[model samples]
Target: MVQTARVLTIGEFSRLTHLSVRTLRRYHEADLLEPAVVDQATGYRYYGVDQIPVAQVIHRLRELDVPLSDVQRILRTPDPGIRAALVAEHLQRLEGVLDRTRAAVVSLRRLLEPDPAPIHVELRSEPARTVAAVEAVVGSGDVEAWFAGAMAELEAAVGDAVTGPPGGTYDNALFEQERGHALVYLPATAPPRVGRVHPVTLPAAELAVTTHVGEHDGVEITYGALGTWVVQNAMSVAGPVREVYLVGPRDAREPAAWRTEIGWPVFRLT
Candidate 1:
């Protein structure tokens, strides 16, 4: 007679795997892990003792927050290289989520902490300059990607003509309603007409300016501080806000070294 494999009931298998019965049932439903057999008369699930390793692998992957679908794919693939690739891809996604969370925590800490010392606000008159710029009505959700692409285009268009740090003008509606017209520009001796970058003259203005030294995640506080200073000093916001990227990602790889100048066009109320 041939030797027979030991068949364990679902409950026993769950205990051996250290996984709950409910989870085992879910894994079966997801087709991630399946038992070896079922009782024809009782319609009960049973697992071969040989399947213990498979159950443990499924449990470990689930613990790592891998989606059920990916887990299924990982398990179904017999090739070790494919399985490792699937796991590595999910780990990369987790790393991105962690990075965003860490940035958010830094911003939240700045918001919850006691107000810092007053930021120095200065008055300066800017002269009109020719620029290669990209203008669009952009939504808040797409602003970062849009700005990056626009800057890239401006860089490609102007080449050696770019004279100063890149800057942008953001309409109030972009903040108030989450969508509005905006312009990302590079100062140039003469504007280059290429791609979406076009010749435009950025007008001269008197601005109440303040520098934000670090990541832009907490720059809202700088804006609020600057706005308060403008109101307290009897200055009125006269036009769209300007942001000068003095030491941006292109200039410095570290966020700590980035310097952004926020310029609020202002006028003395007559």
Candidate 2:
């Protein structure tokens, strides 16, 4: 009875916008998309035909999982450019989340396989050598960003010419306790000391090394395999873990082509 030539009842608006009546009521309560008319005596709601587009926009924003506050900002913004920028910002966040999700799924699939393939490892004697490096005590969550920044500083200080692949040395606590001292270094003889970048003497050790192919996200599996191998071989860890970048992101565009060598400094157990 409330439906008229100039307005639509709740059911009519729901059909047009493809939103449920309950959802419309909730939106109304939220003051996101209030009905244009409300029957005072019956408490029935009616929306103007002009609100169809706005209702549709709200539905689309919700579909993208846009937060209510952001949706409000996007809907209320007068400038189309600003509106687009807000939506674009949310989309970028979604992409980061999707990338992490895909990486996790890939790792999980490999882990779930019935017959996991064995990894090959080699033993090497690494000598003490001073190299250009940055050292910091960082959290596991901040390691990636810290490494990127440190490497950039290293590149700036050391220049493009390098004798060998750059590497990271992570102490046991960094993995075991999730926060500890970590070092990233690029091989350069007589490398300059500037800012956080300085020369570090890498101590000599026997290392059980294994190369992890593809992206670093799933490289944890390789580490697990290497640990298993070391245990089977009666070798106990003697020092910090070292990750030598054989063919890393700087060397290859495709993650599939990247190779990282993980080394565990070890000692034989009786």
Candidate 3:
């Protein structure tokens, strides 16, 4: 009689892997992972010692919340680079979810806090200025990325000739209805013809202005307060809203130090 390599039973494998027997069975049922051997008569499952690493990898990916289908693809792929790219893509998605979660927390905190701060608004007569701008119609979900990219292009086009802070004009539909036309501009002395950056004169207007400090996650609070002030003072909105990035991301590394000036085109009643 010849002695053979000892195969661990499902119970032993479960203990060694620190995974519940039920989960291992579920994985087997899903075809994501299967036992090394199964007793035909008893229907008992066993795993080879060599499969420990495979089980561990599956556990690690599950801990990261990778989708089952993606995990299956990752495990089935023989190319190391492809596996790494798959993991990286999932991590990138997780990062985006984290960003949205943080923003949601900020908005919720603003809503729950008592004694909303007073909004100080000023009337300013803005003069028309020449700007290198990019215009697009975008959904609210894509505004942040679009604004950042447009601003980058405008900044690159205006390089060294930027005369004033960066600003954006947003149609009312953007805030009220979630989709609209948007324009991001950099005031500069340069002429048009830099990529999508084109020369345009921002129209002069009487604006009700207020400054928002910190990241835009909670900037909606400032906008609401300003809107209330405008209505209470008998002012009617005349046109699209303007946002001036005074101490923006381009100037400061910390979001808390960023300053944005919000200007609503308004007509004051006598």
Best by TM-score: 2
lDDT string, candidate 2, 94-176, tens digits: 99889789989999999999999999899999999989999999999999999999999999999965678999999999999
- Model 3 stretches astray by more than 4 angstroms: 1-5, 79-82
Tens digits of lDDT, candidate 1, 124-236: 99988878899999998899889989988889889998898899999999999999999999988888888798988889999999999888877888999999999999999
Give one digit per residue, the lDDT tens place, for model 3 in 1-270: 212257888899999998889999999999988988888767888898998999999999998899889989999999999999999999999998898799789878877889767878999999988888999999999999998888888877888988888889999999888999999998787746678899988899999999998888778888988999999999999999999989977688998899999999999786
Error of 2 at 197 (Å): 2.2
Model 2, total clashes: 0
What is candidate 3's local distance difference test score? 0.89
Residue 92, candidate 3: alpha-carbon lDDT: 98
Backbone clashes counted, model 1: 0
lDDT of each: 0.89, 0.93, 0.89
Which residue segments of model 2 deviate by more than 4 Å? 1-3
Task: Order the candidates by lDDT, highest first.
Answer: 2, 3, 1
The best candidate in terms of lDDT: 2
My TM-score estimates for the predictions, one after another, are: 0.83, 0.89, 0.88
Clashing pairs in 1: none
In model 1, the runs with Cα more than 4 Å from the true position are 1-9, 12-18, 48-66, 73-92
